[model samples]
Target: MNIHEYQAQKILKTFGIKVPYSILASNLEETVYAAKKVFKKTKNYICVIKAQIHAGGRGKGGGIKIAKSIDDVYKKSSNILGRRLVTNQTNKKGKLVNKVIISEYVLNSDKEYYVSIFYDRNIYKNIILYSKEGGLEIEDISKKIYFQKIDPYIGLQEFQIRKIAFHLKMKYSAFNNFIKKLYNAYIYSDASLFEINPFLITNDNEILAIDAKVRLDDNAFFRNLSYKEMSDEREYSIIELEAKKAGLNFLKLDGNVACMVNGAGLAMATMDMIKIYGANPANFLDLGGKADSKRIKKGLDLILKDKKVKLILINIFGGIVRCDIVAEGIIKFFEKKNKINLPIIIRLEGTNVNIAKKILNNSKLHYYYVTSLEEAANKIKVLLKNELRCFI
Candidate 1:
C-alpha cells in the first residue's frame, strides 16, 4: 500500500534518516499552525505546503505550492482543501486533499539523487535502485541506479549499502551514516520498495532525504500497524475497492474495449493485441491463474460496469486454470444476470477446451468462440463496427 509523505518521513526518522522539519495538517487552522511552527524555526524560509495524496506528479498539477509566509500557506491550503487534486498521474476525478504536509524546503542544490527497492518478479528478488540524478524532473533523468540483491533471510548488508552509496557519489564523510540509515529504513519499514528522490546534500554539504516514497508489500500490511494507520480515505475509486474485494486485478484505462485474461503475461498480450487490432482497451483485468467460478463472474461484472465498454473480450489460455471452469463461470454469470446485451468474444485454449466449448454452447447464450487469436481480434473488430453503426 502507498502512503503520504509525512508518514514516510516519520518512518525515515524512526530509522535515523535525517529529513527536513515538517508538520501534518488537515484543515485551514492546522495549516496555519504548521506554517507558524516552521516559521518560528527560521524566517525567510523556503516553505512548501504539499497536498498529501497517494497519487504522484503533484508539482505539475499545482498540488505542491510554495509558501513564503504564513499567509501564503493559509491561502494555498484553503485552495487545495475540499477540492480534488487532479495530476497527470491521477484519474480524471483525482484524489481529495483531506490533509497537507507543510515543510521547510531546501534552499539550494545543484544535483539530486534517488534510491528505491522494488521486487523484480522475473528475477524473484527484491531489487535495490539508486540514482545520482533525482528530483522533480526525475523521469527525464538518465536511470543509472545501482541494483543489489536483497536476501530476505539475511536483510541489507554493508556490501549492498556501499555499492549504492559509492555509485551515488555520496561524500566520503557521510557515506557510511547515509547507507546505514537508508538500509535500516528499508528493512524496518517492511517495505517492498523505498524511494527517496532528490536525497539532497544541502548548501553546507549536509545529506538529507528530501522526499520519500515507500511502497509497502500489501501482504505484509498486518505486521505494520503504522503503515495501516496511514491509509487515507481518498486513495482510489469505488470500483477499484470493489475490484480488490472481488479478488481481481483491475486497472481502469481509456478506451472502448474492456479485456479480461487469466494470467499477468496473457493480460499484457491481450492488451497488445487489442492495440494491434486498432481498438483501445478500457482496462486490464486479470482473473489470475485460478479458474474459480466466482472470480470469473466478478471479473466479468467489473468490466461490464463501465459504460464506455462497447465490447468485452475474455482471452483465457488455461494452464492450471481450466477452460471448462471459465465457461461454466460465464454460463452461471449470464444465468444470474438473466440478460446482458454487451458484445462478448471468448478465446479459450488449453485444458478441456472442447468441454468448455460444449458448456458454453449448451448455455444457449450468444457469444463468438474462435480458435485463433487473429480470428478473435477480427470478430471483436466486427462487433465494434456493428455497435458503432447501431449507435449512429
Candidate 2:
C-alpha cells in the first residue's frame, strides 16, 4: 500500500536517515503554525508546503510551494489544502488533498542523486537503482541510471556498494553506511518500493534524503501491524474500500464493459479480449478461488455502483470455486434488484458447469449465455454496436 510523502519521510527517519524537518497540518491556521515551528526548529526562514497525497509529480501539479514568510506559507497552504491535485501519476479527476506537509527548505546542496530498491519479479531478485542525476525530469534521463541486482540469499554485498559509490564519485566509507542503512530499512519494513529522489549532499558532507516515496507489500501487513495507522482512507474511493473489506479485488476503470473473473490472470485476459473486440473494460474484478454466493453478490453490487458500466461480463473458469454457486449468486442478485437496465454476458466452465448452465437457463433473467470466450466476445461486440447506434 502507498503512503503519503510525509509518512514515508517519517519511516525513513526511524532508520536513522536524515530528512528535512517537517510538520503536518490540515488547515490554514495549523499550516502557518507548522511553518513557524519548522522555521524555528531548522533555523531557516524559507519553508516548503507539500500536499499530502499518494501520487507523485506533486511539484508539477502545483502541490509543492516554497514560502518565504508566514503570510506566504498561509497563502500556499490555503491553495493546496482541500484541493484536488492532478498529476501524471494520478487519474484525470485527481486526488483530494486534505493535509499538507510543512518542511524546512534546504538550499545549496553539493550534489543531488537518486536511489531506490525494489523487488524485480522477472529476475526474482531485489534490485537497487541509482543515478547521479536526480530531479523531476529523472524519467527523461533514465538511460544514465545504473542497476545492481542483489542475491536475496546472501543480501547486499560490499562490492556492490563500492561499485555504486565509485560510479557516482562518492567517498566509499560514507556511501557504504548510507546504503546499508537504506537496505536494512527496506527489508525490515517489508517495502516493495523505497525511493529517494534528490538524495542530497550538503557542503559539510552530510547526506540527507530530500524526497521519499515508499510502497509496502500488502501481504506483509500482518507482520507490520503498526503500518496500518499510516493508511489514508482518502486515497481510495468508497467502493474500493468496500471491496477490500469484502475480500475481493476490484479496480474501477473508465470503460463500458464490467468484468468479473475468478482469478487475477483470467481477469487480465478478459479485459484484454474486451479491448481486442473493440471495447474497453469498465473494471477489474477478481472473485478469487473461493468465492461464494454472498461474495459474488458483493462483487456484482460494486460493479453496478459505477454508472459508466454499460455491460456486465462474468467469465469463470471455476476450479476451487463452483460454477453453480456463481449462477446462484447472479439469480439472487436479479431477484432482489428485479430490474437491471444493462445487459449481462456469462461464460462459465469447469466444476459443475452443466449444472450452472441449467440454473442460469431457468433464472428468467435477460442475459446472453455463451459457451466460449470467442462467442462471448461476439455477443459483446453486437451489444456494444447496438448501444452505440442508440447513442447516435
How displaced is residue 177 in candidate 1, in Å?
A: 2.4
Residue-level lDDT of model 2, residues 44-160, one tens digit each, is 889999999999999999999999999999888888999999999889989999999998898956578999999998889999999988878888897899999998889999899
Backbone clashes per model, in order?
A: 1, 0
What are the models' TM-scores? 0.85, 0.93
User: Best candidate per lDDT, number?
Assistant: 2
Q: How many backbone clashes does candidate 2 have?
A: 0
RMSD of each: 3.4, 2.5
Question: Given candidate 1, what's the lDDT at residue 2?
Answer: 83
In order, candidate lDDTs are: 0.80, 0.89
Candidate with the greatest TM-score versus the true structure: 2
